[model samples]
Target: MDTHSRSFAKALSWRATGTIDTMIISLVITGSIKLAAAIGATEVVTKSLLYYLHERAWLKIPYGRKTAS
Candidate 1:
């Protein structure tokens, strides 16, 4: 089983990559660094929480997991 801290750490690292991608897309569409940054900042918080929850939820499922005897 994965611990809460491990989930949180994974969330943070994934968010960093996702945030950068979001900022780049936002900048291209809006042509504004400020707006892109704001979008990225908001995404970091919201998506991180969502991702952490999603990860934890998946851990509860038994599908596709192998167990040692």
Candidate 2:
């Protein structure tokens, strides 16, 4: 099983990549750096929490995992 800290770290790293993508898309559509940054900032918090929860939940599932006899 993955540790809580490890899950948290993974969430953060994943969020960093997602945030950048969101900001780029926001900037392209809105043509405003400030707006893009605001969108990215909010996404960072909300999505990070969501991702962490999702990761933890997946750890409880028994699908596709190998076990030693």
Candidate 3:
């Protein structure tokens, strides 16, 4: 079953991958380590929260969730 802790862990793991991706793209565009770091750091927080909220919202909808047998 999905739980808050599971959702939180998923958010953190996904944010790690996403932050690195943003950092790489930001570095490519800005050519500045400082700027890339700043952008990545900001997104890490923002997107993680966004994702957690989204997950909780989806959990309530019961659209595609499967029941345990």
Error of 2 at 28 (Å): 0.2
Better model by lDDT: candidate 2 vs candidate 3: 2
Clash count for candidate 3 is 0
Q: 1-31 in candidate 3: lDDT tens per residue?
A: 5799999999999999999999999999999
Off by over 4 Å in 1: none
Task: Give the lowest summed-lDDT range of ten residues in model 1.
Answer: 60-69
Question: Taking the tens digit of each residue's C-alpha lDDT, what string does model 1 give over 1-69?
Answer: 999999999999999999999999999999999999999999999999999999999999999999998
Instruction: Point to the candidate with the largest lDDT.
Output: 1
Tens digits of per-residue lDDT, candidate 2, 1-69, equal 989999999999999999999999999999999999999999999999999999999999999999988
lDDT for predicted candidate 2 compared with the true structure: 0.98
What local lDDT does model 1 show for residue 18?
A: 100
Q: Model 1 shows how many backbone clashes?
A: 0
Q: Model 2, residue 22: displacement in angstroms?
A: 0.4
lDDT of 3: 0.96
